[model samples]
Target chain A: MNRILRLFAVTLIAVVLVEVGYAIPSFSRKYKTSCSTCHYAAPMLNGFGKAFKNNGYRYPAGTDPEMTKEEPVSLGSEGYKKVWPEAIWPSDIPGTSPLSIWGIGRINYAAMNDVKWEFEFPHEVEILYAGTIGENFSFFGELEFENEDNQNEIMYPFALQYDWSPGLHIRAGMVHADPTPNHLKLTRNHYNIASFRSRNRWRFRDEQIGLEVWGAGNGSGERGGYTYRAGVVNGQGINDMNKEKDIYGKVTYKIGGLGETGGTAGAESQTSEFFIDNSVTVGGFFYKGTASRAGFNDEDFTIFGGDVDYWYDRFIVNGALMFMNSGMPGIPERKSMVYYLQGNHVIYPWLIGLIRYEWEDADTDQDAVKPVNAFIPGVTVMARANVKLVLEFKMFLDDVNKKNDTFTLQMNFGL
Target chain B: MNRIKIVVSISLLFLLSQPLFAGDIKGKVKAKGVKHSGDAVVYIEKIDGKTFDVPKDHAKMDQKNLTFIPHVLPVLAGTTVDYLNSDEVLHNVFSPETCVDKFNLGTWPKGQIRSYTFKKSGCIPVMLCNVHPEMEAYVIVLETPYHGVTAKDGTYEIKDVLPGKYELKIWHEKLKGASVVVEVPEHGEVVVNFDIKR
Candidate 1:
């Protein structure tokens, strides 16, 4: 244990050194704006940040004319005008390569009857590429490294999106299909209810290669509106070995405040006496698929869920509930339920407080693994626009009425 | 000698009062296809071979509740504007328009003020906050000082105008209105009504 602790310390020091010694400016350079323009922190997106992403990594409000001018550097009068493509008429490319890197490090201590501590330097590292090809076409891709397992994985979000209008968009590629509450939260400590082990019984995969159509009404401000997404994907995970495909769809309606109109670009300014913008979104999702297992030929799975997100000023509340039913060849039908509730409030521009409760009942028979319940409270601090620090305390009530707890601290840096 | 002095004082007082007798342009704007008709700037177009003096007092626009107060502001060319922040958050003011040289005032905290002088006339520049993308305001710089913004009821009155024929124009953030030639009488008020549309 002492040797492991020493090793962990060395790795943590190395990661911190790298972060402080090197800096790679990314999207901020492309837009000629600071990271704070879109992000509440390194990865957590504010309202404007979400709109920018919905607009295919382009400026949601509109592009500045001066930022769009491109000057060609020529090697010769008629040959090799420029190696790097400049901003063309409708296309604004700040650099030839639209790529960025994000890295995270973590230190975790767990006490499950016995106390244990571990350190992970570069808990995860991601190479992100995103930009607009033209006025309406955009693309995003990411390659990630998970250091705990010492394995490299490709996040299959390589997708192309075309904006038909502010209210309509079509995209096709690998995408996240899980309708869990934590899927959209920007945090390293994921809700245990959506963990891989839990998902095995639920038969819900996080990412799958698929084609999707999604859109929002009133993309401009945080006003009342609606958004929808529907897609079809391979039932299996990244690599599909089965012939069956999964079908999924989700729809959300927003009330109060400015709707998701895609007009966050300063085109419209609110004049109401109220200083804070408020919005609430209620959504539902349905998924049907067939999961192939080694012992069992195939199991038919159906899952349905609902979620709600509310925002007022700097406070936010999010909750989701999912119910699953599955059938196998010889076994009776199995039913399960999983749900979670989370809330976050911004105490300051650089500080936020969060609380979450998660529960899962894997089997209806009560004989299966005892129902698990977990409570988590955390705080996130922004040292800078691209630097974030999070500390969380988690308490778990496992089956058999056993109590376990964990404490974790994570640091993330992105450009 | 006392009689001559008294006569001189009376003459000067009469001369100053004569300018106050100039006609006033009073009007109401009817905006179509929009929520309210407030913040509409009504001004007189440039007079032939005429130039107005820049005012010594600066106009003010405040940042309150993550918004630029008084969504629309009209000012005479060569006037300086004071941008004040009343909210607890930091705010930035900038213009992407070339007419104002595309000036960007860096972020400032609450209770602080930044000033900028607009030199070019006949240009409407949109002001934006880099920190808050949804915060927006407009500054309409004109050559004449005879301008008034409409109230919530769409009423506006521009006073102390010299009796003459001039082009009157109205500007709205999201609407368009036609410029009309109006002759201000030597005395009393001339009522001009405008129908603006999106």
Candidate 2:
């Protein structure tokens, strides 16, 4: 009890200090739009937001609105310094460089026998750079500082995208792999299944070095459109030790709602106009890879999943299901299934109520870990368009339960 | 002899009234694949060997509720437009089109107005706000004053056009536009319909 109280006091003070000291903005700065324009809440993408990301961070019209041209700075006859050498050297290509910063601070308490509590002043801090190199080429890069293994670690994701047309793009570099579309959700807490799978020893959805080709059917509407992505990545994570590469793919289609009906037929570019009513999207994904474990030898992991997101008026519903099959050199094959369902409704313009249920069966065999189920209920408060506060409670259901239920309070703000 | 005289008098009266009356172009625009076709501009293309004087009155576009009140505004070439900010927060108006010289009217507070003159005819400039990226509007400059904006039902009427052959054009922000040629009679109205699709 004393340890828990001491930890709580320290966390509270740290939260107060960070909340008053720092304010950093995100992609809202590059697009010069409000956070709500693409987010149902900060970090959580709506239909339009997904389309924007799939479009290589450019407007659906195939233009980079943030682009600005700058003259080179001369250093007296020696040479000139240009932001983008390609923009001035071989040929003149208009480009813009927009830099932004993002940071999050968290405090958590877990209800256990000892009542554990802890505070992380800043769970993560990231510096983001995104823009266009010319008319058809664009890029996004992130440098991050994170708390890992009780120490600070530096990480980054870099990718370059080439836009062949409004409906076609090829992106190459180290980037986040998408096993489920909710990778961009707004809340600091994650879906139970996503956390469970990501933390597994195999590391299925972690960022990896890869090349992806993606395209969208409609210009930028929230409905009646489709998007597809396929990529090859080093399955061993950022720094690879394996020689074989993994293949992954995802396809999503918007079934019905207000659709995009603009843009010229067969044209490479489009106008920057989109309409949004209620929308829904359904998608499926697959990943196949091989990893070598120290004791287990070489193991093959195959994963397949499906997801859906729907928005109607003030209500939003999302869910995902995944099945995994694993095989080791001399061990019996293991199969498992994980799934989560979530629903959110806007009780007020600034307040949203949410509920989610998740289940995970670690293995199908008799020796498999007892099936785990969780129920989570939360509320999100929007102090402003760029700021949000979340309170979540997690309850566990299991026969041989380890006391792991938790209560979390988080604050996310952008300038 | 009396019937011949009566016919001659009627013919002369008709000829005398022809120049006194001007023709009107009225039509309904059916916009396919868009949120109700409101704010689409229907105007006359430039007439050869003819130039129009800039209107003395300035056109107004208001920024209210974080949106441009009239999403689309059409004006004669060389006419001036006034941008009014009605929101409490600061707002900026600018254009990237070279036809308008890529003008950037810096940020201003509530109730403030900024003015810009568009001298280039046949130029359609998209208006944007740096402070609010989602806020967008269009300024369409035409060579003549004969134009009307469509309502929610896609109905529009361009009144008092001189009787002649002219090309009618449609300017929509989302969909591609098509032009049609029509001959206006000396008097009465011409009812023409257009169906525009993406």
Candidate 3:
């Protein structure tokens, strides 16, 4: 009896040792990432975050030091580009301490007196990274300006994430909804809703708000391919508040198929603020209006839309058709439909060309005649990783006709 | 004669039934040739026997104040790891290598913990915050049970070794130190040293 008991104990001990031995290295390699990176709290992986990991952590270029331009041999606390065989100077700044800066200035058509010149001072000013304060928290914000104050804004992507399982997660806070079809169209897209609409649309506002929660089917914690997001948000976009209380919900689906051999499909339902990854999306929304003030209606409105997008490595095509109808007392029943087709081609990593055609019509003849057909051809140049310079030529026909066929050069940046 | 026989039998029984216990082993670690402090991870891997009380959690690699602290983490297989962020910004963490499980925690802010359980046993090279491109950490997952880290002065000691043969491993971020096989005799002290590349 004693011998058998001792043998059993020994066997148990052996099993545990083997299990621990096997588990140790596996545990170490499995958690290579910090918890906060994926979770709104910890140990969680959101849609975009998962896509990023699954995509092998490959992101847009010029954003990572390991992938950035090589450093030059120099002698200084702060690196200075020395005029040598390469005819280049060390562009990396000094005393910046965790703050890395990249800037671009274009003095094009200089000889022409109305010189189309633009300066982007530290245009792509992403802080690289500030610091992490604990196992579950950290904070960083980015400020950007373009054309020396023509446009300026700061983006704070504060988030908290926690993992429920290897294939499950929960998160909360303000973070960019996984890039939407509208977002993926890139600025190179000519028919983007933002570029064509004269007034802020209800649906576009839904896609961008302060709070969201998204998940996926695989929950493998990868960053690319098919994924989905559904969330509740402040119906009104940032910096806009009305007397009427509102809650917004959106559902988005994305996938990478044959067309996106080296790219992805992205779309969003404007009516509900839903952003889709890279796929066809169908959406619907309803919102209550605030009391009439300054000729605005107190009656609510309902909006719905279907959008589809296709993307190749460098080429993209998309079309979105939407209907917005308002049912307010006293005002005539108002209904409208807007649709646009856009195409984009990557001329180079830093350069892209776009062409778009859009048409908008309202039941009211007055709304339909406002120069609905527009031809916009534009080019976007990557002045830096997060900074871009665009030159767009706009030609309007019929209705709201004006000689705004002007030359506009602008620079934009984001962190 | 009978007394001597009994003592010999008891000693034999103790040797066979229970492993020997030795002095405490401890150490700190330092980066060999860099002004920047390297993140070092220390762990022990029991070679052949399974010890249930010992944990299998992966050592951690954290980003605080724009730097990866304790950059090196050592662990045995099947351990849980806790990744903490001590910063004032959001970060996305992920690794694409096949040897390790990949995950991206998007936009994590202050006071958050992401945990992962490693099921495979091997070393994995990790990168950080797809959004914040500068942070990095590594997981040195080993199969053996004899692992430990060196002190800031690059010294280490391991104790409580049962009589057995173990391959001692010492690792430093950016440096691959030498590994040696040593036997821990019953209740005896053994000295092992290593020199790493700068």
Best of the candidates, DockQ: 2
Q: Every model's DockQ, to 2 decimals?
A: 0.05, 0.06, 0.02
Residue-level lDDT tens digits of model 1 in B1-198: 999999999999988876755799999999998888788999985888889899999999998755688899989999999999765434679988999998888655457788899999999999998676667999999999889899988999999898899989999989999988888888888999899997
DockQ of candidate 3, scored on C-alphas against the true complex (2 decimals): 0.02
The C-alpha lDDT values of all candidates are 0.69, 0.68, 0.44
TM-score of each: 0.61, 0.60, 0.42
- DockQ of the two-chain complex in candidate 1: 0.05
* Cα distance off (Å), candidate 1, residue B85: 14
Which candidate leads in lDDT?
Answer: 1
Between candidates 2 and 3, the DockQ winner: 2
Compose the digit string of candidate 2's lDDT tens values, residues B106-188. 65545778889998888999999754567899999999988999998999998878889999988888886679998887889
Model 2 C-alpha lDDT per residue in residues A1-415, reported as the tens digit of each score: 9977765555432221111111224455544567664566666655445555655655444433422123323322223235445344322222233566666676788877464787866776767676555456767777666654344555566788887764678988854455543334645556554555421255543455688887777634333577778889876655554777888888877765423221222221112211123568788998887775545577778889999978676777888898888877677778888898888887875788988888888786745578888888899888887677888888888766547888878776665
- The whole-model C-alpha lDDT of candidate 1 against the native structure comes to 0.69
TM-score winner, 2 or 3: 2
Q: Least accurate stretch of 10 residues (summed lDDT) in model 3 chain A?
A: A18-27
TM-score, structure 1 vs. true: 0.61
